[model samples]
Target: MVAAIASVASVAARRIRGGEGVATRGRVLLTLDPGALSHLARGRDVVLVTGTNGKTTTAHLLAAALGTLGPVAHNASGANMSDGAVAALATRRHAPRAVLEVDELHLARVADAVSPAVVVLLNLTRDQLDRGSEVAAVATSIRKSLRRHPRTLVVANRDDPVVVATVEGMPRVTWVAASAGWSGDASLCLRCGRQLVAKHEWSCPCGLSQPQADWELDGAAVRGAGVTTPLHLRLPGRFNLGNALAAMAAAHALGVPPGAAADAMADLESVAHRYATVRHGSHELHLLLAKNPAGWAETLPLLKDYPALLLVINAREADGRDTSWLWDVPFEQLPPRPTVASGDRAADVGLRLSYAAVGHQTVDDPLAGLELLPPGEVVAVANYTAFADLWRRLAVMSGR
Candidate 1:
């Protein structure tokens, strides 16, 4: 009865608001019945995906891979909190399998309620410093959750020291040699409080270190369980290759064939709007979302080949009220190009670019900001809310 009411209210709310309303609907349902989530998720084969980055993409890939086996329920819109989990499960109670994207901070609570069959822990990095927990705090929470839920199969990134520390000694762990390029926040050991030394492998003087990965990514192929399958990912970057590996491991843990997982991942064109190209007015804009310093570092390299780019930074609640992390990004790595800065924090981004000796012009409006860049395939990198706003605007313009 509660699930039926929550589902109806959620759908009605979305109809009235004319937005996706995934989060809002879940929030409304949770407000009415606090136990709605646990009740709805009961007796389901739930797969919980959590991390600082790649949660949405990895969840999408895992869910898609699992879809080959049977009907699956997943948080497809990237609403990853407790309410979001409830919304996904409540709406699709008939589905036999559930794939949920869980926030790093809320993983413990969500895991307790969902009792996930498999948990995928992607790379951790400093994200939303003002609002989110410290990287160590998040790692501690995940560690506790893993210890509490001993039966849950953990599909974790062996390359990430924090993830390794979290699931260390836990039984039924499937480790993947996922590549994590950003290490600024992982300089210190979370367990021993010692400086970590990294070369081919990472280790602390106090004895805690990265575990040997069971599934290793060699070039484009993933090797594990006496089998090797070529990972032909449609998503760009080594980070995405890592996400694919994590998904493959999670799928394998859930009895999905390696070949079928890889094939499903290859068919994925984009997660939400991370790499979608849209035509706005006369400019063809390629949209990319980079919410923090580490994300920006990974995204900046893609812009190197482009002639001109649009960089948007908003200090909205979703994007973190603190825009200070912009200085930590290595904007100096960017070559000489006509960069147009946009968003509520456009001036702050322009100042950071100035310190790095990268020339840029600031425009308050994102749509108008495109005027600064020359036409023909302009790349626009936007932080959280800026990216959301632009994505909505682009979608409306494209009549999608």
Candidate 2:
């Protein structure tokens, strides 16, 4: 009966707001039946994907791999909190398998409610500084949750010190050496309170160190469980390779064959807008979203050779009220190029670029900023809200 009502609400929401109503439908369902999430999720094999970054992409890969077994339901649009999870689960009650991308701080609550069969911990980094908890605090919360659910299998990233520390003593853990490019947030040890010694292998004075990974990424190939397969991903960057490895580990934990998982992941074109190219006003814009310093560090290297790029910065609540993290990003590493800054905090981004000695112009609108660049293929990077706005604008302009 609850499923019937929630289904009707989801349909109504889609009719009223189109694709934007996905989260709203979940809200309406939860409001009508507060306990609908657990009821809907019962007796299903749930894979909860959680971390500061790449959760959505990992969930997408896992869903595809698990699809080999049967019908699978997931939060494909990346709405990963309680409301979003409830919406994804309630809307697809007939599917036997469910994959969810859960936010870092909300992992404990969501895990408890769903009693997930597998929990994939990608990596932990400082993101949305003004709105989210500290890195150590989030790690602690995940540790407690893992301790409480001893029966759940954990697919953890060995490259991330914080992630390794969080799931260290869990009974069932599949460690994956998914390389983490950003190391600023993990310079210090999360467990021993001492500085960590870094190298190919990192260890602290307190004896805590990276665990031997059950699954290891060797270039584009992942080796594990007595088999190795090349992971050909359409997505760019080493970070995405790591996301694929994490997904492979989670897939294996759920009884999916390793070779099949790699083949399934290779077919993915994009995770929403991580690497999507769209046309707007006779110009092609490649969209990339970087929310914090760690994310920026990983994303900026991809634009080193571009002749010009558009960068948008916003301080909206979704983007965190604090914009201080912008200074931490190494914008100077890029070859000298004309960068057009946009969004609510356009001046702030311009100021940071100036300090880095990178020449740039400030424009308040994203589209106008893109127009300032010479006509051709261009790259546009933005924070949370700014990225959403740019995506919507591009879609409308292209009649998508």
Candidate 3:
């Protein structure tokens, strides 16, 4: 009774107020009945994907893979807190399985409630500077949570030393060497507190090192469990490949075949405009979203390949108030080209580019900057709120 009312209200609120209403719904349900999520999670197979990045993409892929077996409920709207999980489960009550993307900090609490069948631990990096904890602190919290849920099968990244160290010596674990690219956060050992040496694999002087993998992403193929299955994904970047591998490992732990999971994820082209292309006027804008330094490190190199690049930045509440992380980004590495900075914090990005010796202009509006570009390809890399604004604008322009 409470669940139905809360879901209906949330939908109405979303329609009237705009934006995803999972948060509102979750709040209402919890206010009315605190045990709503626990009640909905009963007698269901659940998979939880949590990390600093790739949580949304990995969860989407895992849900799609699981959808092959039956109707699976998931939070596709990117609302990842306890309330979001509650709202999704409450609304889709009949679905026998659920795959949820949980916030890194909220994972332990959410996992405590739902007790997921499998947990996918992707790479962690510094993000949400104003509000988020340090990488090691977040990992420690997750480690403690996983320790509580002993029966939950953990599918963790073997390539990430922090992730590997978290689940070290834990039973019922499947490791995936997904080739996580960002090494900035894991330069030191989490357990041993020593400098990590990286050659073929990352290891610490205190004996904490990268673990052997049950699943390995080998170029275009995923090899594990005595079979190599090729991934044909439309999503760009090695990070997406790593995400797919993490999803595959989670799916495998939950009884889905790796080949089938790979096949299912191949059709996923975009996840909340992480790598979406939009046509605005004469310019074809390729959209890429990056939040923190690690994300920019992966995204910036991709922007270099484009004919023109647009870097949008925002320092909104959701985007983290601290714009200081901008210095941590390797903007100096970006090739000299036609570039523009626009967003709420366009001036900040413009100043950063100046320090890096990269030539760029600033525009109050990103669409205004788009008018300056030639009628070919333009790659736009934006943070959370910036990407959402651009995505929403393009959606309105296309009348969708």
For every model shown, what is its TM-score relative to the native structure?
0.96, 0.97, 0.96
* Clashing pairs counted in every model: 0, 0, 0
Q: In model 1, which runs have C-alpha deviations exceeding 4 angstroms?
A: 16-20
The digit string of per-residue lDDT tens for model 2 on 197-297 reads 99879989988898998999887788998888888988888888888888888888888998999898888887877688887776777888899887888
Estimate, for each residue in 1-400, the C-alpha lDDT of model 3 and write its tens digit: 7557666657655653223566787877777788778888989999999988888899999988998888888988888898889888877888999998999889988998999999999888899867758888898999999999899999998888889888887788998887777788888899988889999878888988778888887879999878999998998888888889889888887788988998999999888677788888898899888999888877876776788988889999888998999999988898988899899899999999999999988996998987877688999999988988888888889888
- Model 3 weakest lDDT span, ten residues long: 12-21
Q: How high is the lDDT of residue 266 in model 3? A: 95
- What RMSD, rounded to one decimal, does every model reach? 1.5, 1.4, 1.6
Window of ten residues with lowest summed lDDT in model 1: 11-20
What is the C-alpha local distance difference test score of candidate 1? 0.85
Residue 97 in candidate 3 has what lDDT? 94
lDDT of 1 by residue, 1-400 (tens): 7857686767657763222487778888888888888888888889999988888889989988999998888888888898788889877878888999998888999998878889999878888778657888888888988888899999989888888877888998988988777888888888888899998899999888888889988888989767999889888877888888889988888888899999988988888788888888788888888888877777877887777799888998767798888988999898887789889998999899889999888888988888878888889999878888889888887898
| lDDT for each candidate structure | 0.85, 0.86, 0.86
